[model samples]
Target: MTEPIKIDVWSDIACPWCFIGKRKFEGGVAAFQADADAPEVIVEYHSYELSPDTPVDFEGSEIDFLAEHKGMPAEQLRGMLEQVTGVAAAVGLEYNFDILKHTNTVKAHQLLHYAKAQGIQLQAAERLFSAYFTEGRHLGRAEDLADLGAELGLDRADVLRSLNEDEYLPAVRADQAQAQQFGINGVPFFVIDGKYGVSGAQDPDTFAQVLQQVRSERAEEIPA
Candidate 1:
C-alpha cells in the first residue's frame, strides 16, 4: 500500500486569505484525487494567531481594527478589503467584513486543537471560517465555540469544559512554536509531506502540480 501524503496547514481564524486559500487548496486536492492512481492525502490544521494582541471582543469594525493594527489609513484598508472580498466571492465564499467580529483567536485555536484530538479538525476549521467570515459569529468566547463544536457532532459539554480549562492550550502553543521554527510569518502556509512549503493563497493549478510532482518523486524513490 502506498503511504498517504501528509499536509500541515498553518492558519488563523481571523485571516480572510486563509479561508480563501482553504477553498483553493480543497479544489486542488479534489483535482488530484480525480485521477484513479492518485495517492491518499491527509491534512492537519495548525494554530497561528495573526494578531495575538487583538481583544477577545474588539470594539470596532474590521476597517477600524486594520487601521489601528496595521497603521494604515481607513480608506486604503477599505479598498484592500473590497478587493479581498471580490477574490473571496470568486472562490464561492461570502465574506461579510462589515459584521465580522474581530477578536483574539487564542481560544478559537484551542478549540481547533480540541477538535483535532477528536478527529474532526477539518469540519471544525470549515465551521470556524464560515462562522467568523460569513455568519459574523463571535469566535472568542467559549459558549460560541462550544456551540460550533456541537454542530459538528462534538459533545457540547466536553467542548465547553475543554475551552474553560484551557486543556488544549499547550498543543496550540506547540503548533505556534513549530511555525516559528519553520520561519513562517504568515497564515495559510502549507507544509507538504514536511518537505516542501507552499506559501499564500496559491491557485488550484499550483497545488495540483505540487501534488503530482511529489507523487512522481515518491514513486521514483521506491526500489525497482
Candidate 2:
C-alpha cells in the first residue's frame, strides 16, 4: 500500500484566515476522497504566531489591537476586518468579530504540541480556532488552555501541569524556526510531500488539484 501524503500546515489559532483555510482544505480532502485513486492524507499543523508580541490580556477590542499593531486608522481597520469577516462567512464560519478575544497565542500553540503528542492535535486545533474566532474564549493563559484541553477529554491536571512547566515550548519554537527556514512569512502556509508549498487560503479545488498532481507524480517515480 502507498503511504499517505503528508501535509504540514503553518498557522496561528488567532488567524481568522487559517480557520477559513482549514474548512476549505477539509472540503478539498472530501472531494479527493471521492475519487478511487485518491491517497490518504496526514495533516500536521505547525505553530506560527501572527502576533507574538500581543499581550496575554489585551485591554481593547479586536479592532483596537489591529489598529495599534498595523498603524492603521480605526475606521480603516474596521473596514478590513469586516471584509475578512465576510470571507469567513462565505466559507460557513460564523466569525464573531464583535466579541473576538485578541491575545497572545503562545500558550495555545504549546497546548497544540501537547495535543500532537496525544494524537489529537487536529481536534485541539479545531477547538482553539472555534474558541478564538466564534466563541470569544480567551486562550492566553495556562488555566484557560487546560480547560479547553479538558473539554477535549484530556486530563485537566496534566494539561495544566504541562502548560505551566512550558513542556511544549521547544516544539512550538522549532515549528516557527522551520517555518522561517522554509521562507514562510505568512499564516496558512501548506507544504505537501515536503516539496510543494501553497500560500494563503486557496479554494477547495486548488487543494484537491495539488493533491492529485502530487499523487500522480509520486506514482510515476515508483518502479513498477
Candidate 3:
C-alpha cells in the first residue's frame, strides 16, 4: 500500500490568512479525494511566530506591531487590516481585529512541540489557532495555553509544568531553523511530499490541483 500524502504547513496563530487558508486547504482535501484514488492526505502543522519578540504583557493596539514590523503608516495598516477583515468574513470567520492580543507565541510553539510528543500535535495546533484568531484569546500566558492543551487531551499539570519550566524552547527554535533552511519568510507556507513547495495562502483550487498532482506522481512510482 502507498503511504499517505504528506503536507507540512508552516503557520502562525496570529496570521489571519492562515486561518482562512486552513479552511481552503480543507476544501482542497475534500476536492482532491473526489478526483484522485490516492490515500488520504496527512497534514502536519509546523510552528511559526509572526511576532517572536513581542512582550507577554503587550499593551496598545495590534496595529502598532504591524506598523512597526511592516513599515507601514498607521492609517495604511488599518486599511490593510480592514481589507483582510473583509476577506476573513467572506470565509465564514468573524475577525474582530481590535481584540487581537499581540504577544510572543514562542511558548505556544513550545506547547505544540510537547503535544507532538503525545501524538496529538494537529489538535493542539488547531486549538491554538482558534484561540488566537477566531476567539481572540490571549495565547501568551502559560495557564491559558495549558488549558488549551488540556482540552486536547494533554495532561494539564504536565503541560503547565512544561510551560513554567520553559521546556520545548529548543524544539521551537529548531522548527524556526527548519523554516529558514527551507527559505520560508512568511506564514502559511506549505510543502507537499518534501518536493513541492506552496507559498502563501493559496486558493482552494490551487491546493486541490497540487494535491491531485502529488497523488498522481506517487501513484506513478508505486508498483501495481
Best by TM-score: 1
Ranking by lDDT: 1, 2, 3
Model 2 deviation from native, Cα RMSD in Å: 0.9
What global local distance difference test value does model 3 have?
0.84
Candidate 2, 30-94: lDDT as tens digits: 89889877789999999999889999999999988988888999899889889998999999989
lDDT of 1 by residue, 137-202 (tens): 999999999999999999999999999999999999999999999999998999998899999999
Q: For each candidate, what is the lDDT? A: 0.95, 0.94, 0.84
lDDT of candidate model 2 versus the reference: 0.94
What stretches of model 2 exceed 4 Å from their correct place? none
Comparing 2 with 3 on TM-score, the higher-scoring candidate is: 2
Model 3 clashing residue pairs (backbone): none
> In model 1, which regions exceed 4 Å deviation?
none
Worst 10 residues of 2 by lDDT: 29-38
